[model samples]
Target: MRTQTTPPAAPPVRATGRPGRALPLAAVLLAVFVVPMSISGTAVALPGIGADTQAGLAPLQWVVNAFNVAFACFTLVWGSVADIVGRVRAFAAGAAVYAVASAASALATDVLWLDGARALAGIGGAAIFSCGAAIIATAFDGPARARAFALFGTVAGVGVALGPSLAGLLVQGLGWRWVFAVHAAALLLVLLAVPAVAGAVPADGGSGARLDLPGSALFVVAMVLLTTAIVQGSQWGWVSPGVLGLFAAALAVLAVFAVVEDRREHPMLDLSVLRDRRFVGLCLVPVAASFGFVTLLSHLPSYLTAAAGRDTAAAGLIMLLLTAPVLICPMLAAKLVTRGIPALTLIHVSLGCLVVGDLALTLFSPDVKILAVALPMLVTGAGMGLSAGLVDGQALELIDPAKAGMAAGFLNTLRLGSEAIAVAVYGSALATALGTRVDNGIGDHAGASHADLVAARAAGGDLARAAELSGAVDTEGFVRFLARSYDSAFHTVLWGLAAVCAVLCAVIAVLLRGGSGRNSRPAPAGNSPGDRGV
Candidate 1:
């Protein structure tokens, strides 16, 4: 007599219930939106925070970098934790932590306190971001997955697009603290609903399922050291003993992380994922976009308010031109993907827009036209919308569906790390260029000494302060000179970024071509349902 064979249980994606997935999707989208919104929104408030707290440029920068460091270091650990416990549990816990962190940030009386709170928020953000997409991926597949992921990306873009405008209103109407307070309140509401919306998923329970504590500790140490060195490099001098030592120490720690992961039964980062060219190419999307466009989101508002003499609200309005496409293009990309248009094609086209956008910014000048700023922003925003919409879904499709939480975490680690590095590199370059130009301008007309010029540059681009330091009688003329210097520095940065994006675009276009577009259609034989099972 023949015995009956049992098939393995269907993947958790099968358990998420199609007929009632909308509530969960909304919940996840709401959760994901908070992360980017908090990031970009806080950027708009930096100037106010600096002035109010009497903080210098370094502390202002730390407010941003601290969050990024925490987010980057802990993202993979959160991803692994989600897999060990449950995605729903992780999501709920993350929401609660994020809300509490926001409240702490709102109550902060000093820059250090705010920085610490923001870092705590980053820890929560890592959990929510890593698990949120995994929950959505578990709930949808094929065309539905494409649409869901596209919507997910779109929501994130909406947050990015709206961040400056919203922050401006909040800061102008209430105060900078209200920005943190409002998000905290909203997150509290979301936390109450997470239990019902996220439902549940299978949890792994075994020794191999345990968290990679050694790997996690090593990674955290390495990332914190790297980010600290990068952020402080300009202030400390790039070649200073302190800066060089930090970099060397970070490298050593990273080497140890690699060795630890290699010997582990289960690593925090599956190094094998690096072997997949398609995954690497998809990650390049965020790297290029963050380097080329996203880092500028925070700085541009400062430029509008300081250099152009606009108020916070006006600066925010001007940003809408750059941010609006983030809302529109992603929905369109989703429709195209549903109609069998390849995601790679959309991403490639978006990359070309990024190149054009950066080139346009390079050509802009305060003497010629102020409106020229919006044109490049529009193009770049379109690129952001189209590329950001697809990268998450396409990248995740290359990995096991059961590991979607970890996959999302890993992808974000690269993406956020790119943003952190871009901000550090670009900010340093801009400061160096601006300082030199300002010194030359001051020396030529203002008759200022090197000491006075140094003080002016250290004033963090405050023309009034710079003028006071130079004791310039023609204050208006001095401000214009400051503006011109800024324009020149911005042009230099944009030119270099444009070239990098153009080259990376060509490489990714080739990498994403033909048979490698595996996620463009349903899974093939090698990637059948059983292959994706836990």
Candidate 2:
């Protein structure tokens, strides 16, 4: 016993997970950053692409549209697929796919090739977002989980905020192709860290459940039809047979998908998730953002440049005030929660900001050069920022960890779907308002009314084009008239959007109430409340 007791060393304890979390966290955050950046990054390079590829507006638009449409349709699909395979595996596969597509985009010689590559990239982006959120959910817990998601939202918001400027710099310095080339390189680096990421994530290996191919296909089809209808409704006319048919088809497919999921032994989506009022309310937080925040992100710059008489640089700078909160508010909300501020309370405050901010935005005086909209812009941006990840983090906490990917996917689907719907609604409503007010006196002009053509052009902020399209002899007077019409239309739409947000805010409040006072907290995951299909 006395010999410096070299007692048998305890059997080596096998490590159950990676020794550290930093690598995996960094890897996932990098991938998440890349996807949203890609969504917004390529727009700045569009002019350069057109010049190089000899493409017209129709083809050029597809460069952006293909990505958005594909991304919107595939997120839910990828979410379901992630659970079927493994989150890490699906995430790695998506990164690989994204890298390849991005590289292909760089090497493309024509708009068609670029569009195809971008569409492929969108598919990969869907996987990355759905799986990435799930990975965070699995790898982190408690306060760490909340903080990790806060970073997740911050990075995504930063990507969206910086994409245009960063791409513009690259385009000016290197060329448009480098924009995608850089993404390819970055993703490749992310791929290199896959081993570390895999180790950190507990192996939630596949349950050997076969995918619901029929349900997946029908869901994809439904998303396609709905998104396509919204995207094209303005061009085709909302009441046109083509648009109406697409809307009807989407509803029918969705109904079929519901029926299929209801009957399937292993369905892709747990339909009950939709039935959970609190979860549905959580998902709609992003929808509020769609009308109150995203619509401004897309259209506000045009108002500043065309109506406020700001230069592009000035408008871009002003837009920063709107996006800045997105970079900071996520963490602030998370911190508040840690300090015992109920997450639901913060969410309600955020919704109030959106409504108040949208109403305050109407203070813009068409004749004043001052941006009276600054405080309102900040308030609106703060609304978006506070909920960016709070909604997601809370929603995931409510779901079984095994189903986190699906929950993430559904959340993103609503987030993106709302954006598409909101922007389309805003665009069409503005154009229609402008059209109604534009000098209806030109109804006799060649073919359809010049007023209609000019209103559309003006709505697009192509004043020169609008003036030419109007065939007005006094181009200056016509341009002024067009600007005034746009200002009036924009103000009118702001009021309408504010009203819509107020109504939605009330609806969301009721849903969040869930028949219990302000307590919006969901039950723990083991006793998960939503669709338990798979």
Candidate 3:
């Protein structure tokens, strides 16, 4: 009996429609690499940046928050802009903006300057993700598109998975400034290769729709206000008037946005996509990952150092157990789908891994070894790895190719948006939980606010800062108290994340049930996915 194996996925064609098909994938991959790196990598550099600039915590926090805010808000706007201007043009413009902003970040003299530059980079990153995914969606079809998106997913996942480790290396060896400098260099290469990608697609890829100014403005304001409120809620006090006001303002703007979109001749967003229950449901895959995986990805290092009793290097290494699966799973998921596994089945499995793995991760404690938590970490990573590219590719297909940019933008908006929300929620919860524990241990005192600072610093793994803020007679005991308090908080948040992920997974399973309920797709004009899109 002969063994049967699935044939390899088809390769993406060049813009010139000839031999050498890797340019589009390579260029877009390079451009997108920096965006996620910036997202996950900057946290490692924050302390170094703060120390050098002597900036306070609030200003320092903006380095990451500002990037997230701009990235989340501008994706939809950039999606529309990409469709109007052409994907390659839009990608190049975004790369240019990112390059300049990164260069400015490398040269910044103060925290405020760095924050502004990082925000600018986020704006550029918004274009990179929305337009880059749109381009992939347009440039290939069938097996080839799956392969292209699989690689796309893998690169992004790996970028995020390894960002801190790589960024830490850079910060340690060459200083924090060099991290941004490296981003600037990588984006410049992407810019130079844009012509190759441009040639791979149709010149008239745009929908020729006039820009929707009112809708766009409203969306930016709404996302900015909403994400800002969430990011600052922990620091500013969640129930404070300012946070409440921002939430209210965001809601009002969104209400107006809905009305405006309903009335517009050409809305910025395509409402039909939103109305598609399947698309909306599938979009939450990333949202779930944000809570179950990314919250850990960005914050786990702190936990390992401060709570798990690991050193920085050991924490970074152990992180490999969680991130290693992402490197392999995108391709595995694609291969499975190509070989006839139902994508929905795989998604269900992935979500299960995230929730189940997170619950299992309750085993992680100060005395726990890597071998103890390894299985759960791998399971959680597999969950994220399976869905990262698969969900986006499947979700994008549900919409018309002409609206690929919008679809891509909206999908990622939920993705990156949920990431901001998840991280903020997780961080806030951990801080609050830790603060309460510390307050109980220390008892009532005039320096009540100082406990909050110590909790924040300790949870962030800044023991020096936490200690300095503590002003304790016995520093070692205080550190132990901080660690124990943080450990308790870590366990508490894990339970919450697991519960949230399980709920989301169940919801998504229902949404994606009955398989791809998407209307039958027409044959590609040139037998390519993004021909019309380009």
Candidate 4:
């Protein structure tokens, strides 16, 4: 009998040169954008949603933070699962889940239900987000990959920039539910496209690898405790024993996680990656970007509505000027990179723009025109667009192809972690400053007649009220003092952000070490091994 011989399976074909791959890639990019857009867009609609549902401040905060916390915690797990289960299937599952959750959110009767739905959306978001770049990495190479990433980055930037504006429109026209309903529609589009793009890439064979469940558990505990402490410290009092206890627990859990990961095979995160200077820089770039980005996003609306005295709709519109360039800049940067501009140079320039933007806002006065505020915001958005993809691309470039999933997970984890910290810290700072100004103003009027104090208190100690009491007990000086105090507090926060941005820019510039000019050559092409993963 003739010996039967079976041909060995051919290597998995890359989609880089496939016809119409760009269309699917665009769909994938859209899916990624939906996650961030959903979160940011809902922010402007929060007050309206709360009022409609009769939710309190705590619940309102959860409506936003629940998604963020879940997304941050599960990012690595989802990435690892994608590597084991197959990227296409994992991504498709995420889309389906996200769509379901979004639909449920629209019908939610209570704040708790809405928050639960949002948390579910975050789980699905993690699955899609973790695998997004990996799909792009596998499907494109060289200059094509660079451009694809640029497009992807641009889409993300636009989604973020447009989120509040979209929310404003939706709330004005149909109500807040449409903000979520729209995502459900978008998720359906992604679901239909996944099969066409993924082709025959088999499920990953690493499912049997140890998952480091203990380490993951410990990490979750630590992150939760730490984030809660930071977020609640201002409201609860920083020195409160409860806050201190949570911090202590966070440290303990962190220590345990480190110990467990050190001993585990197939650690959820390969700590060894941190030793690479390039990787460290790449990770920090995004962290810094998130710090600056969240600070602006969280506080800008408040500034517009409260200090600038704009209505919700107008405030949302003004905020768009800051975000619009975020969408546009990535495409421009992609073109620049195709011409051989170094990623590091792009990052430095972006950081510089952030510094400049923050500084402008710090110096802004009540007399400043809306255009002046809008201009700085545009600059900031442009900077974010240029920097976002450059860091992701650079980070992937520094890692092995097999480790791309893990590396991406780590980067995302750091990004979200930075954002959480930024929101908590900056929110605390702004609240503290506002409180201090109000308290000082009240104390200065202590010698005023009982009637004046009663009147001031009833008016919420507003600046205008303080001015009204000017004659009650030599109150003109008190009014000027309070006005100056408010101005100082406002500038202090703005200038603080600017200073932070400046420091980040200086560090990145030194580490990146390149001039701003674009290179003339495109990235190398073909089935080049060096171009495989990043």
TM-score of each: 0.88, 0.91, 0.91, 0.84
- Give the per-residue lDDT of model 4 (tens digit) for 1-534: 122222332332354444557567767888988988886787777888898899998988888878887788777776666666666667788889889999998888899999999989988887777778766655665666676777777777777777777788999899989989999999988888877657523333335565667877877778778877876786686779999999999999888887777666666666667766667766777766776666787667655544555576787777778777777788788778766676676777788888787777765564568876777888877777787765676676666555666677778878777887777777666656755665555556646434434333322325546555544355666555554555566677777777776776666666555433222244544444324433
Candidate 4 lDDT (Cα, 0 to 1): 0.70
Off by over 4 Å in 4: 1-19, 200-208, 312-314, 370-375, 443-486, 506-534
In model 4, how large is the Cα lDDT of residue 371?
73
**What ranking emerges by TM-score with the best candidate at the front?**
2, 3, 1, 4
Counting clashing residue pairs in each candidate, in order, gives 0, 0, 4, 0
Candidate 3 per-residue C-alpha lDDT over 1-534 given as tens digits, one digit per residue, 9 for 90 to 100: 222232332243334443344876798998877899888899889989999999998999899999999999999999988888788888899999999999999999999999999999999999999999988877766656666787888999988987887898999999999999999999999999888788766653576789999999999999999998998898788899999999999999999998888777667886756777788888988999999999998888888988767887898789999999999998998778766676777878899999999999999889887898999999999999998788888887777766778889999999999988898899888888887898788543333337766776776777657877877777777777777788888999999999999899889888877665321232333454333222
lDDT (10s digit) by residue, model 1, range 41-146 = 7887998898888888778877877788898888878887777677787777888888999999899989999999999999999898888877766656666666
Candidate 2 on 147-246: residue-level lDDT in tens? 7788999999999889988999999999999999999999999999999888877666855688889998999999999998998999899999999999
The per-residue C-alpha lDDT of model 1 at residue 66 equals 78
* True lDDT of residue 135, candidate 3: 85
lDDT of each: 0.75, 0.84, 0.84, 0.70
Clashing pairs in model 1?
Answer: none
